[model samples]
Target: MSKDKKRADLDEKFQQLRSMTNSTSANKASILVKASNHIRKLKDKIEKLNQELGSTSTYPNTENEHQQDSFPKVNVETLENMFTVNVESEQNCPGLLLTIIQVFEELGLDVLNAEAACNDGFELAAQGVWNEGAESLDAEIVKQVVIEAIRKWMSGTASP
Candidate 1:
């Protein structure tokens, strides 16, 4: 079927399902029964179409994984200072603390103080240290790098 026709058919089926689901207080059991049956039939037909056209290719088509790589854009600012980050991960992942250390190393940043605890969830407390001769390094740059590195590590891409 043409794309337009397929979309229209899907829309019609969705409308039918919605109307059936919304039919309440009919004062008759038969109306509810009929609506339920119609909805079931529509669902079965949708499932069949999904199987035939392939779930990933048909309706509810989602973006490709490669297209969704960039996320949580970093905000850049002009300043020089040092800061700390405390990371907590609710998901059960082993050595989540080590992952943060790896990110700092990969980013070419010095970790002044670092500690981790991973009983309920992974928690990483870290202070990014910077010393540039007599003057300190840009604080904003340090903050941005540390924040970006933590975000990247969480998203499975810690390498720069």
Candidate 2:
């Protein structure tokens, strides 16, 4: 299928997910389970597309056609509402720490604590405090921002 057609289909499925998620009507156990399963499948499809499009990069450019910057990978394992970010970088450039701290600050999240490995490898260990009463975060968005930041930092555009 064409990219546009695939996008449209994804959108349609996403709208169905939203409707089902927000529905107030009484639903049978099977119906709710099916709806949840459908949403999960849709999410998987989106993830596959993201991987194909190099969504982790700052942006894919057709002109460059040969950009070698791959998105930094991150792992977040949390038991509660708190999340711990572990960013891994291959080049380990300068100012990446500051950029990450600034991202949290700009989002109004307080940096409760942070640590990083020295020049040998680029890895940041950070804990952030979100608003006590704020809405829950979108995990995908958080991951995307961190990955994109790492990509930018790797590209040597570590400017604030």
Candidate 3:
């Protein structure tokens, strides 16, 4: 059968399974299991079709690629006497705190205290004081430098 015809048939089968699952009956659990299996097969068929059409994505077509790109949010805040940096990523990035310390040193900032924690991803907060007589260093500049340093580390161009 042609690809279009095959896809249509699979979609019809999926609808039938869905309807079976929704019906109130003693065999609902069995119907649900069958529906799950059918869904998996349908997904595989769709993936194969996508591959044959020259798509390069390895993720299933149902997943949103943009959502995957929206992670790893970074923020920097500088106070009158201290600077704070915050990072939220999808995965824990090792040596991130050390890299922040290194960036602080490179920017002539004194590390007064730093703390980092992680659960699903990572959250790093670094507090520091500017070097004495460094009147040029401000919140915006410090934030920019910290952000750039983290970006470099994430891109593998820099290390802790």
Candidate 4:
């Protein structure tokens, strides 16, 4: 099928899904399951379309793609023996915060506090403490590693 036709069909299906989701005639569980299945089908169709178009990026590019940088802001601060990491992103990329937490865990750091929020964008902040006698837990190194990991993830080059 042509891309335009496929997109139009997908849009029509989405509208049907939205109507079903808002309908009061059916049981909520059944409606939810139907909606979920529709979403999965839509995702699969989108991926197929992307492949047909020879696009390598996982997410579709928005207009003005060159005008905005999607790279999230990452900041690391050290106070005494504690390290605080803050991340802000223009979009709510799924699993970003969890990946950051995993980075700390993989580095043998104890996360004392962690929080994430999303409105129009995503924000994650975490505080961690190193073990009393642990070596190679430098704040700068940890910060760099986290930054690199997030960059790789954003670029769709990270391992799943």
Candidate 5:
């Protein structure tokens, strides 16, 4: 790419990052710093939420190593009818994948691509599209449903 074209592309990406982070700084460095701070804040919030979820719930251990410590951290972003979702936990989750998939189906999201690991800690990153002609959805709604699924799965109400 030409020098000017590369600069323009960089500026465009910075503007997008500023919008996403709700940063109002005009300087590129400030924008980046603010975006970094925003990410740290999000991580702190997720950790706090996981702690709360784990502390408030108690379940009988059935010899499965994953029963007691399985609060999933979820983050979701949406653009138009497309979404990217991330879910993770510090402990294994035996049946959460199916519950989350069921939530996606209930919300009419078609998984376009997904990567998951459950043998150790649970981690899932997925990109999906809203099914054609389905009801409208947004990032917050998707995040809520995913967290709700995790809670239900934790409570043993949702079986794989």
Candidate 6:
């Protein structure tokens, strides 16, 4: 591309970044600095959240904490038409496993092998193949659908 065109593209990207980061700077350098600072703050927030999860719970809101503890960590990996999925959580809800399986079925995914443990905590690892009918599936799409299913399940179980 030409110099002016390249510069314009860069400027447009910087503007987009500024909007995303909620920075109100007109200068490129200022926008960049603000974006960097914004990223640092987000990292700090995530670190603080991790620390809270690691620490003990002594608060009176045990019910709220219990709900948070049920949120599962989901991972998915794709290789060609095959996907490897793992879901783990500190606490197991009764129907969570079924909910996840429903997502795979809805997406026309066939489970080749799987394991599940729900005695102490909930954990599942499965390898599946995408059937020919539905569009090709990727890791993120599979993970997201499973998460949404879990979220709906949790919401229904939450206390009013």
| Candidate that would win on TM-score | 5
Off by over 4 Å in 6: 1-67, 157-160
- For candidate 1, write residues 35-129 as lDDT tens digits: 67765765665455445434322112227644233222222222233446565555444644565566455444567777777676556677764
lDDT per model vs. reference: 0.50, 0.60, 0.62, 0.67, 0.77, 0.73
RMSD of model 6, in Å? 12.5
Using TM-score, rank the candidates from best to worst.
Answer: 5, 6, 4, 2, 3, 1
45-137 in candidate 6: lDDT tens per residue? 545533633432212122676666657888999875689999998886678888888878877889999999999889999998878644345
lDDT of 4 by residue, 16-119 (tens): 65574444434546666777875676466555544544544423344565524676777788764688889888887887777787777766678888888987
> Which has the better lDDT: candidate 3, or candidate 6?
6
Q: Please give the RMSD to the true structure for each candidate, in Å.
A: 22.7, 11.6, 21.9, 20.1, 9.7, 12.5
Best-to-worst order by lDDT is: 5, 6, 4, 3, 2, 1
TM-scores of the candidates are 0.35, 0.51, 0.50, 0.53, 0.57, 0.55
lDDT of each residue in 88-112, candidate 3, tens digit only: 7778777776777787776668877
Query: What clash count does candidate 4 reach?
Result: 0
Winner of 2 and 3 under lDDT: 3
- Between candidates 3 and 6, the one scoring higher on TM-score is 6
Residue range 1-160, candidate 5, lDDT tens digits: 8999999999999998887666788999999999898778756655564464454223233455464445567889999568999998888888888999998987789999999998879999999887886643557656766776787788798867
* Candidate 6 residue pairs that clash: none
Backbone clash total, candidate 5: 0
